[model samples]
Target: MSSSAHSDVAPIVVSDVVKRFDKVTALDHVSLSVLRGETFGLIGPNGSGKTTLIRMLLGLGRPTSGNISVLGRKMPSRQVASRIGYMTQSSALYNELSIRENLAFFGTLYGLRGRRLKERIAATLSLVELAARADSPIQTLSGGMRQRVSLGCALIHEPELIFLDEPTVGIDPELRLAFWEYFAQLNQRGVTLVVSTHHLDEAARCNRLGLLRFGRLLAADSPDALRARSGQQDFEQAFLYFAQQAETAEAGEPTPAAEKEA
Candidate 1:
């Protein structure tokens, strides 16, 4: 669970990022940085803007304000797109295509071809435990199996940074554990990961976590650090403690700490 040392430049950096849909603010001055070779979790309930922020980082959506840079290049940089991989919350697989064919398509899109593409596709399939189903049609697979295919597609190019949005959704607990182990292997090999998930226990497995509520960040730190700061025994309790503090502050009331010392 040790992360590789980071360089001067972070893999993903967000500064005062804001996204608004008319009057609804999806992100409000959101800011954080993800280091290389670490798994950073975005933990929040639904509608907390995790997906919106991830879209901006991937250059799929522009922030209404502020900045985001990935891999030392300004975002939406097509030149560096090949070095980044994204697994969206929804399955993006082609229902009519076989797993191998889907891999081939995505690989070609990432400029992989010929022998190299074949080798990469094979490796990715094995990595996700989908090698046995390589030729199976996407429509024939179960929800979890399909998710694995989507993951394999993203890793086909061996990207340096990956963004996984709720990757463990619909996956069984045992399979989810296996996926986390695979993520550790990727991190050990110098791949950075930005994972958005609502599972608090999985969030605790990350090297660092950003806890979000109502489109605002309540805290950003190691899970253990957050637990210590909030004097809580678990990640969920720590989150609730911070969230309550945020609510009280917004109401101009004394925080829990001030109330404790008073």
Candidate 2:
């Protein structure tokens, strides 16, 4: 199949994307892709350059080198960006705005208005199961509720691709599960997703995951394939094993665990 055929099914394409921060090269030639309707995950510990890569993809940070295309269009462009929704690690909401108002504002930015806008708001609130609290001021909502609202705001325009960066951090476990369940439901209906998370169990739900370390793409594979290759029983072990390998390769030394066992 021609290379273009792949992008038709995969809404996200990262081709040798590199990002640097003055003295630190945050992302070292990172490359990956997320297929349409699939839950693609970026997993790694804190400071693994996961957030940096995410910012680059979302147009919050320009890539120092390389390219990222979303929805078959090059990123940081108005044409391609309209069809994408984004939720950052931090709450990106106006505290004084009501939940419904927040969605409407973001929806308007995506060119949604009138009856169409109203329908989208209700749909998002319902999907996040926050319909009853739609009128609540954003500042009054609990952390988890605020996250749901944040998520709802992202969905107001019905974007083809969604970027969620550490969206579940500080969220209660029960609500976290619910939020993921909502993501799975969206995927079932053909919405593409790229989620960055620290929860290994949650990361396993993704069709494929990219493990990052020090602004580098360490391993990118199906959860099962990664586990099998690393002789691990869970995704966490698979990730740690690969991270250690990457570090060893860079440092030209044995993995600490390997040295200890020896």
Best by TM-score: 1
lDDT against true structure, model 1: 0.87
Model 2 residue runs over 4 Å out of place are 1-9, 251-262
lDDT string, candidate 1, 1-262, tens digits? 1123236688888887789999999988777888889999999999999999898899888889988888877776676788889998987999999999999999999999899999998899989888888999999999998988999888999988999999998899988998899899999999999999999999889999998888888888888888999999888899899899878877785531211100
Clash pairs detected, candidate 1: none
lDDT of 2: 0.82
C-alpha TM-score for every candidate: 0.93, 0.91
Candidate 2 clash pair list: 26-215
Per-residue lDDT of 1-262 in model 2, one digit per residue for the tens?
1245333556777887778778888887777877779888889889988888877777776888898876665767666677789898888899999999999999999999899999999899889888999888998988889999989888889877799999899999899889889899889878888899988888778888888877778778888878888999887788889878877776885532211000
- Deviation from truth (RMSD, Å), model 1: 4.9
